[model samples]
Target chain A: METLKIVKIGGNIIEDETSLNAFLKLFSNLEGKKILVHGGGKRATSVALKLGIESQMVNGRRVTDAKTLEVITMVYGGLVNKNVVAKLQALNVNAIGLTGADVNSISSEKRPIKEVDFGFVGDVKKVAHESIDKLIQADFIPVFCAITHDGNGQLLNTNADTITSQVAIGMSKLYKTSVYYCFELNGVLENIQDKNSVIKHIDSKTYKYLLDRGIIADGMLPKLENCFDALKNGVNTINMGNTDMLIKANDNFTKITL
Target chain B: METLKIVKIGGNIIEDETSLNAFLKLFSNLEGKKILVHGGGKRATSVALKLGIESQMVNGRRVTDAKTLEVITMVYGGLVNKNVVAKLQALNVNAIGLTGADVNSISSEKRPIKEVDFGFVGDVKKVAHESIDKLIQADFIPVFCAITHDGNGQLLNTNADTITSQVAIGMSKLYKTSVYYCFELNGVLENIQDKNSVIKHIDSKTYKYLLDRGIIADGMLPKLENCFDALKNGVNTINMGNTDMLIKANDNFTKITL
Candidate 1:
């Protein structure tokens, strides 16, 4: 079976030039199929300030008001996307920056939650993998931002992790492979306070046990959920850790299996 | 009369980190009310290549197809705007980055040119100066991307020069002052071949002569038109050139008066 990798980077990784450059270098060296999706929270806040608009965050997520929506579109869709593409180009990597709004590659629905207006936030409703697969077949890495479109023609800002997971699951369904969720940390730790206690492998039953025991808390919950989602949706393997661990399958990374 | 300034920077200036730093330094030292609007055409093109999407440019303007539009939004509004704001913040300059779609401060109407689908491009149709003024009044520099809204809630990419001119004209009308259009060039030259043959001053008649002779071509045409429009719209003085010329009204700068 052909191997395809979907990588999701957070704002911390995307905002730091040195880290981004290193990631691009590794991306250039990688074989097989790969897709990159990035987050833009930090950049969006700065833009909000420049427009003299104050950003309102609810439960650690940016509330996309009309003003915030504009900033998100400009920053996620315009600035960071170009920066990544330019860096890859400098290194001779064929990469393309895309959002859900383009060609409707990823169709989403406006998630209007009761009592809380997320503004223009989107929940990924579907993924049209044909265009993405076509690009991958042509040896181009699709660098995506978390922004999406509601079938009604409005751009919606979605969470990077969710978008990446959806793309990974979608690609996994289309082409049997694995999805890697990489970060600066080593991997998901058995103890929240212990960095060296990497949880090597966890099955669906074990993952639920850890969650029930409160071993996985805070930001790690969403990521682990994404991993499980990918596993359930036909992904062969889900790896979570630093890229170094990914490159070598170095025993330290957490592997989610059926 | 209260003084107001609108500065439009080309993408080339922002692309160079050193130039961008120098611009920020000079920008921080300026007094009175001011706003920044910038362009990012080259960056957009670079990102397009990575996605394997070929950029289409007609008559020197980017033909923003759906994919190109996505790239533009990411590069211009997200990366460039945030970088500018971050640099300014590091330098202790209170700066804010914004797009026209934010706060409805800058609104536009879709261009109705037949047969040419300038997909998601806007012509500045309205300028709400009160919100901008409030920001300036609170001592923040507004760094803006040349993107706007099409009144129908869709985001539209706009021309930086046109956006600057419109904002300047609007502010001048509100505050009764002049607007400065600054660039890297040492003003408009009389002899295209001679760099030192700068036209220090051009009245309406001489400006028309230059246009008729075809010496001022392409992008410069819109720039000149913007200058003329600003002047006609009650902006009494228009200056074009480098920062040095703008600061001191030196020999290398072009001054237009009505």
Candidate 2:
């Protein structure tokens, strides 16, 4: 099977122009078919603030009310995603920016109201792998933002990390997919203060041990969950590290294995 | 050759959700291959105003400074374009949203600094007909906003009318192309005040008569230029009318002939 790389960047990297461009330059150099997924929470919040829209976050998840949804649509789907695609095009990469609604590429149902009404938040129901495959086969690198539709005219906010893993899992049916989660940290470090004390390899048993000892919690918790989920669902290789890991062999980056 | 319909909507329709939705429903019912080209100037100006960015217009054209370019990217590329795509998808049109940078489908050069320096504005250079054709042949409708990119990485503000004519002319190389310019008016009116004064046919002689009489001056001047240009090119048919003209046989609309 052919190899495919799916690299995901967080809002922190997207917020910094220098870092984002630097990461994109490296991404443009990666060989073979690839995909870029991005988030724009920081920019969305800033734009919303300027528009006098207060952002309410419940337990680290954004409460995507009606107005917040519009902010993200403009920020994530428009400003950030298009800028990334344009920069990539300049780097000689044929990048096509998209949301779930484009070609019905991704579909999600509104999150059911249980503990909290997430308003227009979407939990992904399907990823149109065949449609995406057509674009990839046509040599077009897709750049996706964290926006999805209900296939019923509703736009919804979604988690970018979830989108990354879901795309990896979906594409694995056609190619051997390797997923990368690039963030601000070196890796999942043994100590938060020590960047060099990276847990280079993380297996199922090691992941449990680290979690029980409070070493892996909070935001990292959901991230690792996505990594493992991708691995279990046909995505072969999953890595978590800083943006630099995509360039060179970095022993400091954490690799997830079964 | 198969027929292709390129529908261009002015910003006024997009500003009102009810009218926009009504128009979209009519557009969705259009037979065979079609493309939707849109302008979001009103919403962009409003958003820019809220952001305290004073819009500069010289001869009815927006002076797209760096900040204004970002504003258009969000309003046109993000909010308006995606909403339209989602709505079209709900109508089962299988729409895909794109800009010039996406797949390198369109390319333009920055307008030169003449008497009035139009900052970051693009003048059409080339349209990637094959790239756009691939999407249409795959049964995906393309919904475009007034944005294009320089090959070097800069995104520029483009006029939607120009984009519509240019795309129609480009696509005519492979298909029988028909372009519809749907504005607020019923059609190009013989008398500005009378609603029933719609000009049914506008050939070169009649158009020259109207121009000499000062009836077809200002904004309508450039619009008619686009229609005639498209007709002169490989495009076979061109019409100017309200959105309702697409739905049925509207004798009130104007049809351009060579």
Candidate 3:
């Protein structure tokens, strides 16, 4: 199988213009088949606040309400995705921006009203791998916003890292897929204060130990869960680091394996 | 060649949820390969105002300054586009919402300052019909919002009618293409006040007479120009009417011909 890379850029990278442009330039330089999945949480929150919509968060995940969904849909699906695509076009990368709603690429169900009614939030049901693969084979790089649709006319806010893993797992059948989780961190750190204390490699057993010891928590917890999910489900490699891990031969990133 | 229909919905339909849903259902029932191009000017304006961005318009064309560009990107590319796509997906149309930047499908250059400095507005340069056709043949209907990209990293506000015609003309090479202009008016009305005064058939000569007589002015002027341009450029037929014209055998439409 030929190589395909799935890169998920977290909200922090997307929040800063300079960092986003820099990341996009490096992303454009990445060879072989690739897909970009992105989140725009910070921008969405700010935009919502400007419109007088209060944002609520529980744990690391957002508590999406009606107005909040519209904000994320506009920010993630429209502003961030299009700008990134235009930048890639400028760099001669054939880019197409998409939400899960486009071409029914990913379908999810509204999270049932259980512990928290994450209003208009979707837990992804399926990824249309065949459809996306066709676009990749035709040489179009897809940039996905962190939004999904329930097949029955509802748009749902989804976790971007989960989207990345689902897409990677789906595509792994056709390619030696590698997943990259790019964020503000150098990598998953043993000590949050010490930049150099990057945990270079982690496996299932080590990850369990880390969880027991409370080393993996908050935002990084859900992200690592996604990484391990991808690895367990046929994805070849998973890397967690800053954008430098894309263009640089950096040893300061955490690699996840099953 | 197989038939391909390009339908451009004026912004009014999109602004009203009921009308847009009615139009989408009518659109999905149309029996062939089709593309839907839409404008969200009203919604964009409203959203811009909510975000405290003043919209400046010169005639019917938006004067897209830096701030206005961002507003449209979020409104047209994100909110309106994604919502429409989700709705169409629900209708089982397999709609893929796009701006010209996606897959490098359409490339435009910034409009030259000839009397009016329409900042960040794009004049249609070329349409990548082949890339679009591949998706069409793959069973995905393209839903284009009136946004285009200059190859140099800028997303420009484009006139939706121009996009409709240009795409039809481009795809006419591979398919017997037809263009539909659906707006608030019944058709090209002989008198602005009379709904029954729709000019049913308009040849190029007749179009000129109407133009000289001031029957075709304001917003309809540039739209008619695009119609004639497409007709001359190998597009087979052009129809201008309200959304009802899509489903009904209505004589309340002006059909353009050479």
Candidate 4:
């Protein structure tokens, strides 16, 4: 199977223009079939605040109201996605941006109203592989924003991490898929404060130990859970590291194993 | 030759939810291959006001400064384009939304600083036909937003009419293309106040005579020019009317001829 890289970037890198461009330059040099997934919560929140839309957050997850969903669609799917595609084009990379609605690539079910009503939020149902595969075969790199639809004309706000994992899992049947979660940190750190304390590898046993020992608690728990889920579900490999990890030959990043 | 309909809708139709959906319902029933091009200037301007971004208009044309361009990308490419695609998907019309940057479908040169420095505005240079043809062949309706790229990392604000015309001209090489300019008006009215004064057919001579007689003037001039240019090129035919004109086969619309 041909190796395909699925890289997911958070708002920290994207909110910083210089760093984003630096990362895109490195990404443009990668020599294989790849896809880029992005989240734009920082800019979305800022714009929401400017527009007097109170962003309600419960348990660190955004409550996506109608207005908030519109903001994210504009910021994530429009401004950030297009800018990234254009910049990659300038770097001579053939990149095309997409929302799940485009080509019906990703379909989701609107989250059920629970304790907190996350209006217009969606949990992904599936990622259509054939449409994506066609673009890939035509030599176009797919760039995705964290927005989806319910196949009933409703645009739903989704988590970028899940999008990355889902896309990785969906493409695993046809390719040797490797998923990378790129962020501001170096990797899963042994010492959270120390930039040099990068953990090179973690298996299922090691992950459970880390979580039980509280070394991998808090916000990192769900992220790592997504990484492990992808690996368990046939995605060949999963890694977490800073943006430069891909450009440099060294696997200085944290690797997840089954 | 297989006939392809290229429909362009202005902000008047898009800014209204009921009308937009009504039009999409008719568009969904379109028999053969089709493309939808749209502009969202009203929403963009409203968004700019809410975000404290002062919109600058010179001679009724928006001077697209950097901030204005960003707003339009969010409004047109993100908010409007995705909604249209999702609605079409719900209607079971496989539709994919695109900016010029996506698939490198449209490339433009930034308008040079002549008298009015229309910052970040672009005049289209070329439209890539093969990528679009591939999508159409794969049974996906291409929905375009009036946002293009300079092919050198810059996203530019472009006019929707010009985009419609240029795309029709480009696609004429592979298909018998028919361009439709859908707006609030029924058609080119002989009397601006009378809705029934639709000029059913207009050739070059009739068009010139109308303009010379002071009947066709103001905003309609540039729109007519675009239609004539498309017809002058390889585009098979051009029509201007309300959205219903596409559904009703009576052709109670203005047909531009050379």
Candidate 5:
């Protein structure tokens, strides 16, 4: 199987112009097949406020009502995705922007109302691996926004981290896929306030020890769990870091393994 | 050569919920390989107003300043394009949404500054016909919005009619292509007020007479000119009508020719 790199970027880099340009320049230089997954940040909230749509959240997760979904569809799928693609094109990389709805690339089921009604949020149920593989084989880079469709004319807001994991797992059938969760942090830090306390590696034993020590809790727990899920599946390797780790061999990141 | 249908739709149908759905249904049912080109209407203007971006128009064409371009990218490329593609998917059509930046499908040069610095607008320079052909051959429907890229990290506002013509001309190399300009009007009306005054056929001679008599003036003039240009450049046929013309054989439209 050929090697493929799948990178997921969150709000921190996306909202900053300088960081986005610098990161995109390095991403454009990555060799072989690559996929980019992006998360919408405060832009959606600000745009919603401007449009007079009030955003609702439960447990730090957005409740994607119809209006909020429309805002995200416009911001994440449109502004952010196209901007990244255009920049990549400037560097001679053939990039295609996509949502789950395009070419039925990914399909999801609306999250059922269990305790909290998350409105139009979806849990990914399927990935069109064959279709995406064809795109990669044709030398086109796929830039995905965190919006999906139900295959029934409904677009749903989804989690970018989960999307990255699912897509990496799907493509693992034909390629040795490595998934990177790229954000502002250098890596998983032992001391939350210290950027230098990056955890270099976390095997299952180390993961258990970190959890027992109560160092890795809350949001970081879910993210690490998602990475572990991908690793346990078919994804070859998983890394969490800033953009520089992808370009240079730096230990300022967290590498996950069984 | 295989037959290809390229349809361009304006704002009338897009702004209306019921009408847009009906048109998308008809579009999905159309036989053979097809491409859809869409225009963003008052939605961009309204959204701009909300975002505090002032729109400038010169000779009825938008003066796309940097701010205006961002709004349109959000509206046209994001909101409208995704909605259309998702609807088509519900009808079981394999639909993919595209901007010129995606897959480098289309490339343009920023319109050089003359009297008006129409900020970030672009003139169509090249179309990646081969990449599009591969997509069509793989049984995917390409839905395009009126946003293009300069191949240099900039997304430019473009005329939807010109995008339609350029794409039709580009695809004419490998397929027998027809371009349909679908909008509010049934066809070219002999009398502007009478809905039943549609002219059934128009050749170069008839078109000249219409212009000479001040009949095909203003907006219709540029549309007809684009049609003629496409016909002269190997496009097999061109039609102007409502959505119904695409579904059934109806004489309530005008056919253009040399």
Candidate 6:
């Protein structure tokens, strides 16, 4: 059997109804194998603000303090996860929405990055592919939120891209397949402002050269790093581009190579 | 100071974009006291079907088996809650999406109903209205999911109507205000098919008469019961009718009287 395809949707794609519906329509036609992982930082930030709570962000990652964690739990684990599942259903896709804590499907440890006490932030350490595989075998697509459990059984907020990459790598190792990072942008661009300036392909060396030249900044840096990591961890092929472009195998995507 | 009004929306209201937007528009203008509690049983049922998990219902209540519990968590607590919050936000209304388990704000105990093991279903035993009131005071509408936590700290899926009623009753006592159950229908009818044949008002006596006459059946029964319960719990007024009628105090609604 072919290994499953793991797709990661950024906060930008999942934030609005139009993009969400578009993604769902494409998702409905997806054949073979797939799993979806989504980010909820933007939604979380908006909710936090409404509640008069100031979100603390350090280097684009949310500083998940106790109060922020509560907001995140409501926004990510409770809100965004279901929204995606509902959209998938509206498109007639059989999607099973899940959090890592649900069945211990994804396990992690408190990241505590850079000695900053980011309360409940997690770094995913294990992916229970077998359970997810069973659901997929039963023809249900697993729609995952980026929350996970520390091995000692505490709920922690993990980065969505990291979680998506971990799941893709885990699935690839289990079945030896490829993983694709799908977003609103048309792959890694040679020039950020120009739509037609997408870099068609890049080796590990070229990717580092672009990063060194300051071509990737902000969110895209982490995304490219995640792609690089996924490739290292048994994932044979990694593609990053617009969701529709990926579905149609359009020439507007960047294929990361060894 | 005048007491704040807490308006609770049923899951039926939040099922689609048109109804949701309609409710939000009406809600936006109604300044003063407001809180939103929504149902997700319909969406949960649809998701359960898609996942090949049979959702068993006993006495019109979802018999949330383990798998069904998972589905409800993702659908009701996650998807439906966020969508409502987002819609409210888009209208520039500060809305905070929350689950009962988020801050131990709403606590319950799982009461296995009539020998059926409704895996994680809960009956509302206690509600901490202070936190919710604070949010309302800050001009933030707290949108809640019907999932609650057992005092011992287990998440139990509760009926949205029951939860909304409890929250309304609790808030009414604390703030001494009215709670309105707004729907698409004109209110409880003498006949379901005849829209104009609305029961103008009902008390305990008329409530029993309608039940005995078999006018109120199925899902409408619980809503009526909840309305009566809220009235009994010292809520000053209970309006059961269409959104426009409730907002404008239109004469077409069936007011539940003491």
Candidate 2 per-residue lDDT over residues B1-258, each given as its tens digit: 999999999988998989999999999999999999999858888889988899999888769999999999999999999999999999998999988888887889999998889999999899998989988877889999999999888999998988998899899999999889998788888888898799999988998888898989888898788778778888888888899899776567988876
| Model 6 C-alpha lDDT per residue in residues A1-258, reported as the tens digit of each score | 586777788788888778877887887787777788888858778666755678777767558886676567666777566556645654656565666654356778887657466778888888877756665665667788887766453567888878877887778756766667776678888888997788888779998888899988888887777777778887877878888764665667888877
Give stretches of model 4 more than 4 Å off.
A205-216, B191-193, B205-215
State fnat for each of the candidate structures: 0.20, 0.83, 0.86, 0.86, 0.82, 0.13
After superposition of all CA atoms, the RMSD between model 2 and the true structure is 2.2
Q: Is the docking of candidate 1 incorrect, acceptable, medium or high quality?
A: incorrect
Candidate 1, residues B1-258, lDDT tens digits: the string is: 777767777887888888778887777666777777788757767655745678787777657776676667677876576556656655655555666754356778878877677777888998877756655665657788877765443567888888887887777757755556667678887776787778888889988888899878877787787678778887877878776654543557888887
DockQ of each: 0.09, 0.83, 0.85, 0.83, 0.82, 0.07
In model 3, the runs with Cα more than 4 Å from the true position are A57-61, A191-193, A205-222, B57-61, B190-193, B205-222
Off by over 4 Å in 1: A58-61, A208-214, B1-258
Clashing pairs in 3: none
* Superior by DockQ: candidate 3 or candidate 6: 3
In model 2, what are the clashing residue pairs, if there are any? none
Model 5 per-residue lDDT tens digits across residues B25-79: 8888889899999999899999999988888888776798988888999999999
Q: In candidate 3, how many Å is residue B190 off? A: 4.4
Give TM-score, chain B, model 6.
Answer: 0.86
Tens-place lDDT digits, model 6, residues B112-175: 6576667778899988676556555545567778887664535678877777778877777577
Predict model 4's lDDT versus the native. 0.90
Error of 1 at A21 (Å): 1.3
When sorted by DockQ, best at the front, the candidate numbers are 3, 2, 4, 5, 1, 6
DockQ winner between candidates 1 and 4:
4
What's the true lDDT of residue B136 in model 3? 90
Tell me the TM-score of each prediction against the true structure. Answer: 0.53, 0.94, 0.93, 0.95, 0.95, 0.52
Residue A236 displacement in candidate 6 (angstroms): 1.7
Number of the candidate with higher DockQ, 1 or 6: 1
